[model samples]
Structure formats: C-alpha cells, structure tokens
Target chain A: MSTAPTTEKGRRTRARIVDAAAELFYERGVSATGLGDVIAASGTGKGQLYHFFTDKGDLVSAVIRHQVEGTLAPQRELGLHRLADLQEWARQAVLQHERSPVMRCPLGSLVVELSNRNADAASALEAGFAQWRELMSGWIAQLQRRGEARTDLPADDLADSILAAYQGGLVLARSRGDLRPLETALAMAIEGIGSRRAPAGRHRAHG
Target chain B: MSTAPTTEKGRRTRARIVDAAAELFYERGVSATGLGDVIAASGTGKGQLYHFFTDKGDLVSAVIRHQVEGTLAPQRELGLHRLADLQEWARQAVLQHERSPVMRCPLGSLVVELSNRNADAASALEAGFAQWRELMSGWIAQLQRRGEARTDLPADDLADSILAAYQGGLVLARSRGDLRPLETALAMAIEGIGSRRAPAGRHRAHG
Candidate 1:
C-alpha cells in the first residue's frame, strides 16, 4: 500500500459513498441499512470504504453532512434573495416536496431514526437543523429589512415556525401520500405572515 | 373443553394486555415490540394472549383502537366550548407532551411504522387519523360558531395543520430527546391563530 489513493480521487469516492448512502437511507431507514448495502451501492470495495470511514457511524455522519449541505445550498442560493417573494418561495418549497414524494427530507428522517440510538448521529442531525434554522432566520431577517415580513414576531421565532410548519407539512404529506396538506399548510403560513400588514377589518382568514 | 374466558376477570385481563401493548408500542415502536414482550409486560400467558387476540396484528389493531379512544375521550370531555381560549388550550396541549417526555403519540407512531408494511395495520392507523381529524374539525367548526376562530381557513385544513404540527413536534422532540421543540411549535401555532384578529401592528414574538 505505497501511496494512498490520490486526494482528489479519494474525495470523489467519498462523495459517491455519501450520495449512495443518502439515497438508501431515505428509501429504507438508517436502522435497516447495512455497510454492505452502502458498499454495494457506492461500488467501492470494503477496503476503500474502511479507508475512508472508520465505521458505519462515521459513514452515516458523513452522509448527514452531505445531505445537509446539498439541501441547504439551493435555499441559500435562491431563497435568500427571494424572501420578499413569499408566494414564489412557498411554491418552490412545496414543489420540492412534491418532486420527491416517496423520499421525504433525509435529515428529518435520519434524526428521528438515530436521535436516540447514536450520539454521533444526533449531533450530526442537530448541526444540520441548526444550519437550516440559521439560514431560515437570516432569510426572515432579510425580509424584515425589506419590510416584507411582520416586524412583530421576532425574526428567529418566525423562522422557527416556518421551518416547523414545513417539516410538519412533509410529515403529513408522507403519511397521507398526498401533497395537498403541504400546500395548504404553507399557503396558510405565508398568509399568516402577510396578514400582519393588512388592515384590522381585512384581517379575515385567507384559506 | 374449558369455558372461553368471557368473564369479568377475563375481560379485565384482556384490557390490561391491550393497554400494555399500546404503551410499549408507543415507546419502543411497533416493529421492535414483540408478543412475548407484551405477555411479560401484561402479566398474561401466551395462550391467554392468543385466546384474546388472534395474532400480533390483531393485538396491534386493538391497541390502536384503545389509544384512539383514550386520546379522544379527554378532548371530548374538554368540549368545544372552550375553543376560544386558545392560550389555555395550547398550554394544556404543550403540558400533555411535557408530562411524558419519552412517550410518542401512539396513533401517529403506528401510522408511520405500519403504513408502509402492513395493510391491516395501515387501515387501523388510517381510521385513527380519520377519527382524530374528524374530532378536530368538529372542534374548529364549533369554534367558528362561537366566534372564536375566523372561518378563513377551512376547518379541515386548520385541523390538519394543528395535527401535523403536533406530529412533527413529536418527531422533533424525540430526535432531540427534549420537549422544547414541541412546546415551541405549539405555542407559535396558537399565537399565529391569535394574531388573526390583530391589525397591521407589531406583537411580541410568542416563542
């Protein structure tokens, strides 16, 4: 074993393994997947896998990080600037869930599965959630700066509610095998935000 | 042949088994719990359990029904008359989750675990959810009549959102092994509802 695989190739291999693991983990829960499955899906031999990650827990942590970064990149790139366009942002979020109906958010699923079982996994999940919350909070703050969202609710709490509803919508959609709940919940949440600026009498429900 | 155990004592034993199964199912999950575990926890023998329940699935169905009724009865007793007291309602809901930090919602948990695997179990889960939705929708409608909630969002969608958030909060709380997420989510949701009547003015962030 003269020289280890080149750093570039090793990086590529690790990414491959993580991507494969993410897909498998989403389809079947983390508790149900195995190292063999990861290896087979990634098309990397056991030696390469072992070289890259010390154990299954290590691999799962990598997968969680990969998924968090992958999912967050889009929101940061496109959503940050579009905070004022609440309707469009809501539509995009709903579409994202509809696009992957069978596979709900992997970060959420992983958190539920591994939170109690593995401390490492729980930490990884918390990191992912914190990243999401921070991104969302920043977006909300931007909206406030633009006079888009209500300044009444603290930006952070509002951000948290939005995220909570989004996650909740995903769960409802998955359970019902329907996307209407997600659509309705998002629409209502956005409406809740917009209503903050309406006149007292016009503060009617917006279902 | 011995007489079938239909006596009062036999009925009590069967009820105990179902209650124990429901508790274990909620805590450890349906798939992880076994009939033997139920037998041990319920202080019932294998033959007695089989006599009461045809199989594990049968017992699971019974447990689902029992939990559904258990949850529903309290809400029914609380009555829709107090729907206007959103703050107290929200507080009570949050307190319910706080009371049992480790125990998940049995019906919701069952829906997630069994919806993908067993048809009968899925049906049972569906019925429970349907009943729950119905109960909530009824409460919301009553609130509308009492001028508590605006008729803007349909009762069904509003009920669904509340239920969805509750389920999502449970998942979030379980993942963190803490109840703050659940509490925060519920409090924010109630605040959103309360803010419905406010004019374009700043209110303190609830969470």
Candidate 2:
C-alpha cells in the first residue's frame, strides 16, 4: 500500500486530536465529550478527524493508551528508588494532587468511566494498572529488602495499598475540592510503613 | 395545587425508577445510562418518568440522594457506641467490597462523573461526603475519647485518611477487578491507628 504524502503531517494531526481528546475526556468525561468537541479542541476538520480515528470509541482507546504512556513515563523513570524515604515520596504524591485541584487522576477517571461498558477500554486500563503496579512493586520489594517496610506484608500488596491511598486521596480531594485529604491520606500511609504502634497519650482535640 | 389521588402509587413508582437508576448508574455509570434506559429498566412510561423526575438531571439528583442515604444509613445505625469496634467496622467495609465485586461505590462514581459539568450534582456529592465525613469524624472523636487512636493526627484528618483509603481502595479494586487492594489498604490504615511500631510479619503466599 502506497502511503499518502500527508501521512507524516496526518500522524502529527492525529496526535494532536488524541491529546485534545484526552484532556476533554479527563475534564468532561469520555461519554460526555462528542466528536464536535474533539474536532474543535484539536483545530481539525470533521473529515480529518474521522480520517485519523475511525470513531469516538477508537479515539477513546487511543486516548487511554496515550494517557497511560504519558502518566507512566515519569513514574517509571523516577523508579521508586526512594522507597526508603516513603514520607518524601508520599509528600511528592500529595503535591501532585495539590498541583491539580480539580482533575484528580486522569487514568483513574478513564477507568471508572469505561470499565463497565467497554471491554477494550477495561483491558487497556488493566494493562496500564498492571504496569504501574509492577513498577510500585519493584520499589516496595526494594524497601522490603532494606527492612523499611515489614517483611510479612507482601511487597506487591503494600504497593497496591499505597497506590490505593494515593488514588483514593485524589478522589476525595476532588470531591471536597480540597487537597487536604490527599495530604492526610498520603501522610498516614507513609506513617504506617514505619510504625505499627500508635504514639502514646496523644489525644485528638475535639473541634 | 391539588395532589393527585394516586400520589402514593405515583411516589412508589417514582421511587422504583430512582432505585433502578441508582443501580444502573452505579454499575454502568450515570453518563452511560440514559433516561430511556431508566424508564425501560423501571418499566415506567415516559409520562410517569417525566411526572416524577422532570429531566435527566432531576432524576440524577434524586438518585444521588438515594445513594447517599443508602451509604450513610448503615453507618448511622452503627452509632457512636460502635467506636470500640472501629477496626471491625473497617474490616467490614473491605468485606463489603469483596462481596460485591462488580459494584463500585456509587457516590464516589457520581463524584467522578459529575463533579465538573453539574453544579447541583457536585453540591449533592459534596454534601453527601461532608455528612459522611462528619459521621466518621464523630466516630474518630469517640475513639479518641476512649483513648483508641493516637491524638497527634486531628480527628478530621484521621477521618479523611480513613475515607481516602477506602475510596482509593475502591478505585484500585475496580481497576484490578479484585478486592485485595481494598483489604490491604484498610488493614494498613487500621493498623496505623494505635501504633507507630511495624506490624508483625504475616505474608500470605500467592499460589
């Protein structure tokens, strides 16, 4: 098959469409954002848009994959080498949530939006999560090796727990329209890693 | 304004529609489930559906309230007296997720879906969360009175972390399509309550 002369430019245009779609999908939602919105956001025509991606579902799948890579790249590169300093890592995570007060987790939003209706979307979500879990698990395994975390709890399980706290913090933060929840959750989860016994005689002040 | 003679029956029918909508909304998401689907699911005609809900947004608000009560009722019944069994309560929450593998937390789901586009929906979500947070803060306060959780973390913050973990656990569990993350995060949060010491090793072997 002979490639069209516009193939490279078309590829760039398609990337722009996917990027715009990902943002809108994260902001409004996958089902809520229509083809017109994507076309407008990408500054591409209707024909150009359909030429790049066959339909809305195809566009969504592409967006999910695009988001997965965008989100995973930094985390994978950072490499959890600092698991021994869980508090610092946790603080950084909290800061990430703080950076975006409204959006929360884009990938998480996508998963929740598409998990039930679209199997391909669900599988893509699961695969992305699997990669993320593996990355965190590797970090946790390092912590286990260093005795930073209890050897009794499976490193992967701990990693999952940590991820849950971070993700959940994001949800709560978004719901409350405040980042305090994220900070609190992340701090507590980090605090959990080092200690099993609560500090004595510290009383909660009633408001 | 004269009430219809069949007001009681109408109310019942409306309740059924909202209940069915809530379930489908939780399972398939609010954006995915249309008013027609709600009508079909509830076995109600368009006139009846409109008589009760007026619009899809109206129906959504009703469903949000319905879900809010469904979530808060059981916990409200638990009362301040159940503070001693906070760990047990936490464990039961994880079990709830385990038992219902496919059902994501509807309130959380709604918050994710509607937080951006709909103010009324967002306010309803915030109110629901606030009410729940108050209940949880009260529980933590009761625990503090009983000298259970460490006093250093404020009761509100403690409650926030607990809620954040559970919500985050739901996201993780939903994505992985499993309950282990929920279980682990809940256990870890609970363990963090009264201690700073690392928990005893009890690794479960994965076959």
Best by lDDT: 2
Question: What 10-residue stretch in candidate 2 chain A is worst by lDDT?
Answer: A198-207
Q: Tell me candidate 2's interface RMSD.
A: 8.8
**Model 2, residue A205: C-alpha shift (Å):** 32
- How well does model 2 score by local distance difference test? 0.76
After superposition, candidate 2 runs with Cα above 4 Å error:
A1-6, A83-85, A99-101, A195-207, B1-6, B79-84, B195-207
Q: What share of the true interface contacts does each candidate keep?
A: 0.29, 0.65
lDDT of candidate 1 over B84-161, digit per residue (tens):
554566567778877775536666665555535556666666677778778888877777676666676788888777
- After superposition, candidate 1 runs with Cα above 4 Å error: A1-13, A43-55, A82-84, A101-103, A115-117, A198-207, B1-17, B34-36, B43-59, B115-117, B174-178, B191-207
Q: State the lDDT of candidate 1 residue by residue for A118-190, as single tens digits.
A: 6787787887887887887787778777766767777766666676677677766766777777777666666
lDDT by residue (tens digit), candidate 2, A1-207: 111236778778888888999988888888788899999999999988877676787787788789999988877767565544566776766667666646468888877777555777787888888888888788878876765665667778877777888888887877888877887888778756642222233332210
TM-scores, all models, native as reference:
0.82, 0.87
The window of 10 residues in a row where model 2 chain B has the poorest summed lDDT is B198-207
DockQ of candidate 2 (2 decimals): 0.40
lDDT per residue as tens, model 2, B6-42: 6778778888898889988888888778988998999
Candidate 2, residue B18: CA error in Å?
1.3
